[model samples]
Target: MSKSQATPNSAATGAESPDAILFREGMSRAAAAVHVVTTDGEAGRAGFTATAVTPVTDSPASLLVCVNTASRSAQALLANRAFCVNTLGAEDLALADIFAGRTGLQGQDRFTVGAWEKLETGSPALTTSLVSFDCRISDARVVATHHVIIGEIVGIRLGERKPPLIYQGRHYHKL
Candidate 1:
């Protein structure tokens, strides 16, 4: 997890700035899908939990993933050049917690949280995920406090009538 940094602002007087408070407040209200990102590299197999995953565009079949530089898994993803985003289900709370850094499991240890398999692109897709996207990263940009990764989807393992796990107000919700 990336630690929140104090942004220097001329308008702000105290420790917390208006921009920081508003950003957190906005994120707190916005519900997001829970996903586990996995990658295999020459260094080793690595995976991490991410809630900042979103579909960017379909014209090029692409999506955006925001990864914190503080995470070792981010480096692994950069080295591997491929990754899979496993969209969680309502029953995947245990798996989500494990990957979300709430269970104290790091790196490959988190893989033991659930049954995993590989897609055609060789990225690890959870066997029980609601949906899985196998992608090769096309570009990466470090913006703000995260690395915004752009990936081109080449394969998809879609589920049937599966609802996604959601996170809102710092808590998990089932859709």
Candidate 2:
């Protein structure tokens, strides 16, 4: 049985406390698409590399993105109430590292490394991303150390099909 299945009664019996480290380790095995979530508005322009964006619904064309509450971009994203999810291609590995803060650049400085353009929401959309979703924040809730943002898609930009950049096992993968 899987670890999650084995722990079915853990929450009820309090017999097996959830281990954060173990949970993260298990999650690391799962592959996730890499994206750069960006925003530009009165709050200022900000962007960050992320892997926690997912579709939440289709009726209203919505997506959910988890942003670290302490991240520098969080304040701007919240204040602006708009964002763009730029799905990266395999060639964007270096761009990902820059936006992820591996290069020590912050705020608008991150944009200097990539070509960008504004979409419907005025958020910075990556010019060569595999795909870009411009959205308006429909709602947001803080959970633990992250802010769960619900975005209503307003525009979408599609680029040439290419191998996507994926994150798994604490590393990048191309597929």
Candidate 3:
């Protein structure tokens, strides 16, 4: 059968149904870069590891970052109206784990584990990140259990060229 001519089961239900499991499983096969999204302001300093980030357009130099609405950093990200997407290098796995909440760290404590500096938005940017995009939140929309944040690039920091940290099939890979 041609690629698009084949169809999987069509009896799947809604997001909370078995289809959700299947959907997650399917997504696991796709490789994505790992990043630590950080924000700091009146709300507070907060950061989290995530893979759900992408460029939306270059005309405006914007990107989208998806954060769970219940994430510890959500409030700060919204209140600050800005963030920094720190793309990790392969050597930053432990940093990613700390931000991912695997180390039981919270809020500013996560920053203690990494080297950080402030960028255009005054958001904490990773000094050792492969690259960091400092941005201002242009818009935010809630979808399912997460907030899709639209960020307009205000500044960008490029670090040394190195293998990036990637996630696929529930594991981290360097490339």
Worst 10 residues of 3 by lDDT: 10-19
Enumerate residue pairs that collide in model 3. none
Report the C-alpha lDDT of model 3 over 24-139, residue by residue, as the tens digit.
87789999999999998989899999999999999899999999999979888999999999999999999999999998887788888878999989999898899999999999
Rank by lDDT (best first): 2, 3, 1
Candidate 1 lDDT over 1-175, as tens digits, reads: 2345445565665555547676787688889889988888675788877888989999899889999987888888988898999888988888988877888887778887678888876778998898899999999988877899999998999866677889999899988
lDDT of 1: 0.84
Scored by TM-score, the top model is 2
Predicted candidate 2 versus true structure: per-residue lDDT over 78-174, tens digit per residue: 9999999999999999999999999988777788887999999999999999999999999999999999999999999998899999999999999
Report the C-alpha displacement of residue 81, candidate 2, in angstroms.
0.4
Instruction: Evaluate all candidate structures by whole-model CA lDDT and list the values in order.
Output: 0.84, 0.93, 0.91
Candidate 2's displacement at residue 160, Å, is 0.9
Which of 2 and 3 is the better model by TM-score?
A: 2
C-alpha RMSD (angstroms) for model 3: 3.5
- Which is superior by lDDT, 1 or 2? 2
Give the distance in Å from residue 39's predicted Cα in candidate 2 to where it truly belongs: 0.3
